[model samples]
Target: MKGRLFLIPVTLGSPDYRYVIPEKVLEIIISLRKFIVEDIRSARRFLRMIDPRFPIDESEFMILNKHTDYKDLDGMMSFLKEGSDTGLMSEAGIPGVADPGSDLVLQAHENGFRVIPLIGPSSIYLALMSSGLNGQNFAFNGYLPIKRADRIREIKNLQTMARRGQSQIFMETPYRNMKLLEDIAATLDNNIYLCIAANITHPDEYITTRTVSDWLKKGFPDIDKKPAIFIIGIKS
Candidate 1:
């Protein structure tokens, strides 16, 4: 019995070649046996949208989310121990990046399961490419602190790195994008360049680069309720 795992990233709901899963990758999904998804419901919806004929049964799906309890983890581990080939899929984007699938991957690896990641859309790298910032060196700070003071302190430290020509990237829940933008405007220097890449690969996608001051004056764009990524760069 051989234990195997596949990391599948669901970029947007569609399978566009540019920034979402490529055509070749779509074939991989059709052949997978077991699916370990962040949100089993959402994963099912996405799969239906991609291809209505996709053979994914609800029973074969396993939920591995952040809020998963110990019992769930133990059950999943037991399933993996039976030499099952599993597929890890996030609600959106690649598994193990900003998703809870990272822990599952680590656990699988520790248990001697073979882990393979298929290339797909990553908003972090896409934001970096379009940010017009220092691409040679960059760090994805993941999500920022929720508390005002802590977030400010974290941004200040990130500001220091940006000033030295390091690109700093981070994201927030879709609904909190405006709040995150406001914080950046208030705390970051006027001259620092900021890039807001929203809804990447989506129908109404937007990517813009401007100074913090200019962004403040113009007010944050009407991003509505869409997934977005933010990148900040301080002139060296």
Candidate 2:
């Protein structure tokens, strides 16, 4: 019988897993000696953070990321077929949902492996629930285009959907967060509300929702190099 695939979740940035990670999830992570991970170093660090004495040497890890070849997935799946329960983890947050582990989960399903998803912090949902935006109807647009012009165009398109009562959520690279905020303030109407949730789950976490005009007057936060979520919607 094939072993199960556990979809694991890790903390956003806080080293203290007690804050965001549940006890059950931590135990599951500790039990799994073999893992299919996005970043081996980070995965190992997380394991050790949860339990100082975690055996780093005995564990086996298979890399799964943009650079990972598709052919390597079948090899990674071997652990399950051989009755070794495996855990799939991301650098932060839970597996899947804008994560590379989605591919591995899909493969597991197709091969008839039992996949169990553990509960934990998700930057996307965490931001949305805090933002007083339209929760019943919303979309996660992942990352916006890098080019200024193209990103502005996409922002406008998202606003169109937002106008119909659907909220638009997107992100930008940490270094370019300020630039994205600028475009959002410049292109969006004053009444359009923007939610900026930065450094989520960290001690310095900041989450706020304000009108474009109000945000312009107050000046954007110093979040240039911080991971963040940008949500656009209209209160009315």
Q: Which candidate has the top score in TM-score? A: 2
Candidate 2: 10-residue stretch with minimal lDDT:
13-22
Reference-based TM-score of each model: 0.90, 0.97
Per-residue alpha-carbon lDDT of candidate 2 for residues 85-166, written as tens digits (9 for 90 to 100): 9999998898988988888899999999999999999999999999999999999999999888999999999999999999
Which ranges in model 2 have alpha carbons more than 4 Å from their true place? none
- The per-residue C-alpha lDDT of model 2 at residue 236 equals 52
Indicate the TM-score of model 2: 0.97
lDDT of 1 by residue, 1-236 (tens): 87578888686644564456777777777667678888878888777766788777643888888898744665676556777767889977889988788888888887788888988888888888887888998999999999988988898889898988889999888888887777888799999999999988878779999998888788789775778898999654
Question: What's the C-alpha lDDT at position 109 in model 1?
Answer: 81
- Colliding pairs, model 1: none
RMSD of each: 2.3, 1.0
